[model samples]
Target: MQIASPLINELQCGERLNHAIEHGRRGEFALLLAMLSQDARDMAQFTLGEEGTVDAKLRRQFELPPAQTLVADVADDSLVNNGGEFHELGLRGFALQQALKPEALVTRGPISVTMLDALNNTDPLCKSRYLEPQHPALPEIPHFNDRLSGQLALAQRMAQA
Candidate 1:
């Protein structure tokens, strides 16, 4: 099965932000962290991996408001950890950034012109789960599943009429 890409937009970010705040208020760390931006997600994962760090850093970030000064001060650094240690970039900061400016996360680097061609050429309906073809091909008659065979035969007769 093909995996659909995650939808991220201003409206979606705003909804997620509100949901995350509710989760934080309820002290649901896992649920709150799940709504974090990619960068914050990575930081949370790394922080959780380190022994004796969650209670002191990441959990506190989850409890605070996104607009708080502590949350707003987190710097967006490279994904890599150079010195074999994880730094706290504040998950609240990431959430605030996402809420205030979702376009930054949506913006991708320069892509090949062929990308647009592929998108334009693709049939959007072909990917739909509920799509029904107007002229469906009849299956082999008198095959397995007697009910389906009878239905196909009736359809074939109807088409000829």
Candidate 2:
């Protein structure tokens, strides 16, 4: 009988999580939650940060009960230095290693809570924090209106030309 390394098992768990998010598999997410080690689960929940508040607010507005367990609440800024946005795109391996380092989690705070939240509720069709700006539950910022007007003006100019 062969023994699997803990690191290898964790990596596989992370991969399963990634697949669940990418494919929007709520059932798979549930299974992953069940199978994930407590440490990994804690890391996932810790990463939700501000996103957890956002999720709670939205849930209350919709009359949904407050979430008890982790809900894939992705962190705004943890792995990436890019202004509170997720930057690790298409990272192939080391999902658990990259995601759940205790030192990193403690130092940098929750890095991927949004994905944790996604596992619970795959609705709204935009699970990743990177797409959070488009989530309907989140109100549009005032600057977004100014930016939109500028974009429309630019588009009009191009059309006239």
Candidate 3:
């Protein structure tokens, strides 16, 4: 769908991917992952050259709003009449596409053992892989304490000035 460079990653290949989990229905996120064809996934990585993750793309493609803070164990009603909450967000199409058929692919609890394994691995397309980035390490900043001290000193100087 005209995916730009750097192809959405949250460590599924970036921190931006968490919005999907925070906003999506319990276990429903997996269905979204399945919807993305393998070729689409591969093409994304091929274009980015760094194993693309799909979260950000989905958000932008579907015109999703930013997610609010939500409980981890919230129960999903999966009912349209209850409040039309998902419909209000324009996700009815998403529900129709991913929920109506292929019943086994969508779920509400913790993913199956195999699914978890797939996500934990380096599969760029695995939604879980994006949840936790591989080889996660903080980058070093030179000067250690000097940078903070220097900034503080500069602030003090500006205050005096």
- Highest lDDT among the candidates is held by which one? 2
Query: Can you give the lDDT of residue 54 in candidate 2?
Result: 68
Candidate 1 lDDT tens digits, 1-161:
43243222223344655775666665544544444444433343344454455555655767843331222211334222222221344666555554544322222322233544444454433322112352132223333588788898999999999
Q: Residue 115's C-alpha lDDT in candidate 3? A: 52
Give me the overall lDDT of model 2.
0.49
| Global Cα RMSD, each model | 24.5, 21.4, 21.6
| Cα RMSD for predicted model 2 | 21.4
What is residue 74's positional error in candidate 2, in angstroms?
Answer: 52
lDDT by residue (72-119, candidate 3, tens digit) is: 212445422322545565677556644443223333433344555555
Q: What shift in Å separates residue 79 of candidate 3 from its native position after superposition? A: 6.4
Residue 47 lDDT, candidate 1, scale 0-100: 42
TM-score of each: 0.16, 0.19, 0.19
